[model samples]
Target chain A: MSQGRERVYINDVAPRDGLQIEKQWVATADKVRLIDGLMATGLARVEATSFVSPRAIPNLADAAEVVQGIRRVSGVGIVVLVPNVKGCERALASGVDEINLVMSASESHSRANLRMSPEQSLAQFAEIVDLAKGSGVFVNGSLSTAFGCPFDGEVPQSRVLGFIERLLELGVEGVTLADTTGMANPAQVARLCEAVMTRWSQVPFTLHVHNTRGMGLANCLAAWQSGVTQFDAALGGLGGCPFAPGATGNVCTEDLVHMFEQMGVDTGVDLAALIELSTTLPELVGHDVPGQVAKAGPADRRYPCPAGL
Target chain B: MSQGRERVYINDVAPRDGLQIEKQWVATADKVRLIDGLMATGLARVEATSFVSPRAIPNLADAAEVVQGIRRVSGVGIVVLVPNVKGCERALASGVDEINLVMSASESHSRANLRMSPEQSLAQFAEIVDLAKGSGVFVNGSLSTAFGCPFDGEVPQSRVLGFIERLLELGVEGVTLADTTGMANPAQVARLCEAVMTRWSQVPFTLHVHNTRGMGLANCLAAWQSGVTQFDAALGGLGGCPFAPGATGNVCTEDLVHMFEQMGVDTGVDLAALIELSTTLPELVGHDVPGQVAKAGPADRRYPCPAGL
Candidate 1:
């Protein structure tokens, strides 16, 4: 419990991870409103949108408009998801503060999802990393299926280490270990984070997990214990893997914040505001969302004494 | 991580704690069916019913019949919730293997919920404890609101230790520290369990947490790290404090079991069978249940490769 007082960093991935698979097309104005709502709650970093081809993810086809429509705050950094050099070029012109590059740890997943071998994806990333170096934009490399690959199953830790080494050498400022389909357990999370943190002590490491198996936050806690604090969560748990049929969504950002704040960990989040915004998600998506704090409220929240009692 | 491989004991409190507040009167036979289903999943302990007045908890009014009707499996124990000497007398006659006595650490919660002051409740517990010493039944004293009280708020660790001393002195074989309204945080849970285990090393400590703030499993993980292993959870996250207005439900037993099993901690539970039973709960209660794993599947469950991919 010594880490109870430590401040944990959070990066909301709702606009990118959460909304990627939404069938209902949200208006660009609505996406901008949601992003502004999240920024108003004191989140330092918000993954606002992704610059993928409209044919790849039509729901986020308005990514450029979203970045253009959302008000920019002084301290909040906006993140844009980019897959290749072309996406990076679009993101650089889109005025985002950071760009996140995606790759896969397993060749099967890389071929199925990204249509490239791991090495091919890394080679493409090298160009994107080099292209963005002098543009004043931070590049974050994310390794998908780092915990377990649905297509191949049981990704080797050595593959993750190799990817990390190459990503760092590519001049990426940070790396995200993405549990693309929520396949990680706490023990596995601890072992991987320990191995990575021991060797590359200076590189910023973040966890991108899903609640597919309901171990998302448990894995986050294990990562924190292993000395990795930065995390990526989605508001209302909006996103899931389209290829992975049963994958739920990324860990709910508000629920994660509620847990951290309750445990006396400083998250620099306004829980009341977050919960309030979480309630509006059901109407936004035309369905009820998966967040918990919106339904349960904070721990100290009190109800009025019953009439008779 | 050191405790990742340890086996944790689970007491499925669905019949007693779960159905106690259910609006639909789950037929007495349905209760028996549910209990039988749980027992077949290799769970060692099942809290069968409560022996309180039928008018007090009408849902469990068939407690005696449920105890008599459920199929008994070898190596499994049935526990009943008892509030006073009369409940204890009835539970003893019903032939439950264990009886859990309830009191609250906060005087306000005790009076509001049980209509007795803390001291008066303990005095009555003394008689109930004396009556069943040689009756071949294990006595468990549960301090409700020991973690935090909705009425009084922030129950002190000193008060909990004082109550633990009294319960142990009264010959209770075990004590369960209950987060009655889900107010306990992870750090608070770790600190309190550490203090209690330090003073009463021989007493069996179990955790009974609610998901009021969605910290149920997190608190259990904290308590587990502090050397407490036994826990009480409800299937499908059923049951909350009927008196605490905003309290949600207990930790989802299958979700907790899934998390533990994924981390290589054994609960001897057949997860596939438990999951199968969880899918039937929505029809049993006529509404959606709160459990996560049922909808999300297990961590290792893989979907078939899509045709094009």
Candidate 2:
């Protein structure tokens, strides 16, 4: 039997990654209410919004208003995705607790998504880190398509490791390895997570996986068995990749918490509260979200015997 | 890293378990075609149909015709669920390779689903075994609610082991531990699977799981890591429990095969062929199925860069 971690930390990225691609415009008030509802559920961190170009992602245009409107809890971290030094400046001015810088591990994905090469993205990240150095805001770097790219089939583990080294050297405090297109399998997740946990023992690494192919929970189980203590999930499984159309988004937060809690691991989040919050997502997004626990209830839920049986 | 089993065996139970719960009646020819298509995908076994009372499960009322109409492939076992000596006689006369006997481990589930106590079910199983003893037919006993039950919250592991011992003593050749309500978590699956593997080293054990709470693939991963090589899956994630309304049915066969194959474990089945067959399920069932690989494609599927990127 594998000696899995005893507890896990989860960052709900629904407000940012989950909503950025949505066609309907979520009002600024509704976005704040959603983030605050998530925070009330005791999430470790909430990726409130992304301070990217509004022209590129019009849905999350009110990133600053969202960050400023949320009821900041003392222990909960409010994170926002920042694209460059300009976005970083906006996020810091909004009094965010953490600034999440973005980059891609694959060349084609880097060009397609960010409109910059990997090297160019790294140079921008270095400038953002320098800008946020003395501001006391935690710096997290999210490496998109770290597992595989839609255009470029596989991103080598050695290349991912090299980028991690560069990100840390640029004064980034934490790193998130994102399976942007839901291409990661359990064995591969275990191998890569083990490699990072072994090499960067002191650095905190988070796994961000999509459920496009239905291996989301299995990949999370593999990563947990390999000693990963932090994860990135979206409420109602809300995020999707523009490149992989018809694909589901990140692993659902309530479902992931249900799995871990059922396995006797502590996630420090109220599952019932999370599920209750997830029910309002359809109205918020104008469509159904992919979360299952909310629809199916938790595993511990019992049913009455069939009538007359 | 877990030294998981090198190869896995899959039994597609869509024809029996998946179709039995459907609200619409599936035509016998379509059922035969589905089973034949699944077998042609190089599956190790296919549960063609069940010989239960038509009043209880009308969808599978054409059991004998389904068993006789399917093109028998060499090296692929054709199995059927037999509820009593009558079902066993019909299945044996139809020239099936295996007869599956089922009973619930939980008392409430046993009474509610099968309308019999555990002891009564065991007695009936012994009678069927005696009837099929000299027919050269393999006896496979399936213990439903082996993990947890909807009416009775948790089924103890020790109680499950006792039932397995009884099934073996009754001349059962193999056993399937079923999570009837999708109540199983990965830790529970790992513990039960490891116990069974350690105690009954020679007996072939199959895991039957549901995706009700979204832990289906995770539970499969745990069971696989605990030395389980045989799995029971339904094509297109068909099937649901009558007790747990709104719950999804058996784990998707195509999704499971995709996961195992992507992990570099040999499943001995053609995944692309399986997915191709999954596309026809919506038209056959008159509804969209829940399998994701069929919707999103496999992990290795590549896409061209977005226009102008």
Best by TM-score, which number? Answer: 2
For residues B55-153, could you state the per-residue lDDT of candidate 1 as single tens digits?
998898898999999899987889999988999999999888999999999877787788878899899999999999899999999999988777676
TM-score of 2: 0.99
Indicate the worst ten consecutive residues by lDDT in candidate 1 chain A: A300-309
lDDT of each residue in A1-309, candidate 2, tens digit only: 447578899999999989998889999999999999999998999999999999989998888888889998989999999999899999989998999988999988999989999999999988999999899999999898898998999999999999999999999999999999999999999999999999999999999999998899999999998889899999999999776666689999999999999989999999999999999999999998888899888878888887787
Question: When superposed on Cα atoms, how far off is each prediction in RMSD?
Answer: 1.9, 1.1
The native-contact fractions of the candidates, in order shown, are 0.44, 0.81
Candidate 2 has an interface RMSD (Å) of 1.5
Model 2 local distance difference test score: 0.92
Which regions of candidate 1 deviate over 4 angstroms? A241-248, A307-309, B241-248
TM-score of chain B of 2: 0.98
Tally clashing residue pairs in candidate 2: 2
Candidate 1 overall Cα lDDT vs. reference? 0.86
Ten residues in a row with the worst lDDT in model 1 chain B?
B239-248
Top candidate when judged by lDDT against the true structure = 2
Per-residue lDDT of A1-309 in model 1, one digit per residue for the tens? 745438888999988887787878888999999999999998879999999999998988998999999899988899999988888999999899999999999878888889888999989998998889889998999999999887788889998999999999989899999999888988899999999999999999999998876677778877887888899999887788665454458998988898888777788989889888888888888887777678766767665543444
